[model samples]
Target: MAFFPSLNLVARRLGMYRSGGKGAWLFLPTSSLARSRPGRLRPFHAAFSTSAGAQHSEEENIDHESSLGRAGISAFKRAVLARHSTKAFDAKREIADETLAAILALTLRCPTSFNVQPYTVTIVQSEDMKQKLAACMLGPNSARVLQAPVTAVFAADLDPVQLVPRVQSLERRKRGLPEAYLATLPFSVAFLAGKGHLAHAFKDLFTTAMSPLQPMPSVSTLEAWSYKNTAIAASWYMLSCSVHGLDTCPMEGFDGRRIMHELHIPASRYAIPLVVSTGFAMPLPSSSPERNEEAKKSPRFPPEAVVFKDQYGHAYKGISQL
Candidate 1:
C-alpha cells in the first residue's frame, strides 16, 4: 500500500484539508500522491497546498515582517520629531481644500470608545468668520487665529442621543453584523447615556462592587466621556497636520460660549474642547539666533521619570539607557 499521511495529521499540520464524512481524505495534488513511496510518508510543504492557502500564507508572512521592520518605525519617528506648536503662521499661505480634507479623513480614523465618534470639527475659512473667531480668543491666541488662513474648532457632543445610535448602526451594518446584534444598540446607548444622576450612581455602585472579581471600566458622565474621546481625535488632527507639512497651534483660550453663538452651534448639545489654527509657519528672522536656539531645544521629561515598569513608582529596567 502507498504511504500517505492520515487526514487528521494532515489537517493538524497543514490546516488546508477539506471537511466531510467517513471516506473524506486530504486533497493533495495527484502528482504528489503518486510520488509517495510504499511504507514511507512524504513531508508536505505549504507550497504544495491549495493556491488560496499559499496566497494566505504569503500575505501573513509579508504582514508579519513589515510590521516589525524599521521603515515604519523611522517614518513615525520623523512625524513626531517634525510636529511643533507654531507661535506664528504666515498670513499669505493657505492650505488646499484637498489637503485639509485628507487630514480630516485621517483624523476621523482615531479610535473612540464603542466606536461612537461624539465630536464635530467646524472649519473656519472665511476672513470675516476668522476675524469674528479671533475676537472670541484671548490675547496672543487671538492674533494666531487671525494670522492663520484656516482654523478648526473641535467640539464634543454632550448628548449621545443625537449621534450614538445612528453611528453604531451604520458601523455594525458595514461589518455585516446580525440584526439581533444591531438591535441592542439603542439599549447600549441608553445605558451609556444613563437616564439621570440617580441611575448612574446605582450603575456605578454595581460596577464598582464587581471590580474585585473582574475588570470594569469606571462609568463617567456623558459630558466627561465626550470630552475624553474628542481630545483623542484632536491630538490625531494635529499629528495629521504635521504629516501634511502644515504647522498647527492648538488653542484652549477661546471663549466657548461666544464661539458656540458665533457658529450657531447649540451650547446645550455640544462643548468646545479645542481650537486649532493650521497654516505655513512664519519664517524665523536670521537675526534672532538666541530665539532660534530656544525653539530647537523644546524640553520634555525623560521616559524614566514618566514610565513605570509594571506598577506605579517601580523603576523600569534599562529605561534610563534609552
Candidate 2:
C-alpha cells in the first residue's frame, strides 16, 4: 500500500540517517533510482506535466524518463499521473464486473485509522437506480451521474466508535493475539465517543489540559472522525478506477438525506461523504470548445510553494535545491 517506493530512494540519495540495528528502519535504494545522480535533482516543472489535453505544447509534456530515470513507470505513479476528474462519461461504455471487482479490491486495501475501515461503498448500476440517484445530485453533477455506467456512494458510519471493538477483536484473533488485549475495548470506545454532553465536556477538558504537555488530536465529534477516514477510502477508490483504465468524477453536490433515503441507507447509522461516478470518458469533438476546456488540467502550485521541511515557512531542502 506504500504508494511511493521512491521515498526510500530519495532518502538514500539525500544521505538520510537511519538507526542501525535489528528491527530498525532501513533506508534501501531501489533499482529505479539506481541510475539517478545522488546530488542532482530534477526540476519540478520538467518532472511531470499536469496538462491532460493533447493541445499542450511540447515543453508541457511529461519527461518521465528524465524525471523517474526508470524504463517503465510504476502502476502507482501511472495512476496518479493519469487521473483527472472526468466531467462526462461515454454512456455506451460500461466497466466489466471483473474490472470493477479488482478496483474495489485495491480500494479496500487503503489504510484507515486503527484499521476500522469506517466507510461503505454503495454501487449503483441499474438505469432506474442511476436516475433516482441523479435526481438527488445538484447542478451539472446530475447529468454526469446519469451519463456514467456506475456511481459509487461513499458513506461513513455515524457511530464508528461502536465498530472499533469488533474490528480490533477480529484482527487480534486472526493474528492469534491474546484476547486479554481487548479488555479495555469498551472503556476505550466510551472514552473516544464521549457519549453525553457531560462526558464530552470532560473529554474536552482532558484533551485541553494534556495538549500543553504533549500532542493530542484536536477534539472533535465521532462524525468528523468518520468523515476523515471515509474521505481517504474515497480518494483511493478514484485512483483505483483510474488504474483500471476508467475515469471518475467525485461529486459533493448531492442531497445527502435524499441519497440515504433513496438507497435505504439508515441516516442514524451512516452519513454520505461523497459519491463518485465511474466510466470511460466521452471522446471530445474537434469543434467542442467546452469539452476541450474541461479536458485541460488546472495549474498546480510547485512543491516548494506548498511543501515545508523541519518547520513551517522553511522550504524543503531537497525540493528547493532542484
Clashes of each: 0, 0
For candidate 1, what is the total of clashing residue pairs?
Answer: 0
TM-scores of the candidates are: 0.74, 0.72
Best by lDDT: 1
List model 2 lDDT by residue over 251-293, tens digit each.
8999999999999999988999899999998998878774654
Q: Which candidate number would show the highest TM-score if scored against the true structure? A: 1
Please provide, for model 1 over 1-322, each residue's C-alpha lDDT reduced to its tens digit, 9 standing for 90 to 100. Answer: 0133353453433322333333222333333345534323322221221232224545665755346468877877667677788889999988999999999999999987556688999999998999899999998999899999999999998877667567656856665543433443443444565547886786576446534534444678877878898999999998999888888988899899999999998898899989999999888888866346346446777777778888988867666321
Q: Please give the CA lDDT of all the candidate structures.
A: 0.71, 0.70
- Runs of candidate 2 with Cα error greater than 4 angstroms are 1-73, 178-180, 193-201, 287-295, 317-322
